[model samples]
Target: MLAYRMRHRIQFQRRVQTQDPNTGEIIVSWETVLFSGRLDVPAEVLTGPGRELIAADAQQAETTARINCRWFPVDRLELYTWRILWDGRIFNITSAETDRTARQEWRLRCSDGLTDGQ
Candidate 1:
């Protein structure tokens, strides 16, 4: 059996804004994100026509969207929505702020047994 090895890692960085209730000045915070995962391609999947390996450069360029003060404001009374970009689509993942600091393994593989046809 053979496995597709990941050639590189995915990374993200964020800037958050906090405000002084009294001064109304914005304070910025920076966060670094790191993700490691593999891409699984099944032999049963097709490699031509509708089924093809996704472009290597595009796949390697995949990175998580950055969440900033514009998305999550400090003065705002409500929580902001989180956004994620997969493939070429932009999606909203959550409507609440992630108020915790914890690291866990995040795995994402194409079970569809298809690549981007590149």
Candidate 2:
């Protein structure tokens, strides 16, 4: 995708646990990992009539974002622990793909959830 289409700012987060020193309680939170990235809507979302496409997409699943960011090494085993936040919506990291050939960028497939991350 062109850099211009990546106008949205996306943040990467991971689930983390911390101890409340005084209360001895375990605190769970989403910690920011990579600062932010340029984001873009996948082509499928823009292929048809605006209203009709949105209506059809809504029936299937929550919003999905294709986040494009400069290449970075990500531990594959920990993919499930990540989340992407953009425009105030927090998304579960459904999958992550790397551009091994060029090693110039990586994309993430994220889906918004209704539970805790919301």
- Candidate with best TM-score: 2
- What TM-score would you give candidate 1 relative to the actual structure? 0.23
Candidate 2, residues 1-117, lDDT tens digits: the string is 466665555666778889999999999887677433434332211111212133435643355556666665668558668776676767676676777674767666666643435
Q: Please, what are the lDDT tens digits per residue for candidate 1 over residues 17-75?
A: 79989999988654333233323212111112223344745433232232221122222
Off by over 4 Å in 2: 34-61, 100-102, 116-118
Clashes of 2: 0
Give the alpha-carbon lDDT of every model.
0.29, 0.59
Q: What lDDT score goes with residue 40 in model 1? A: 20
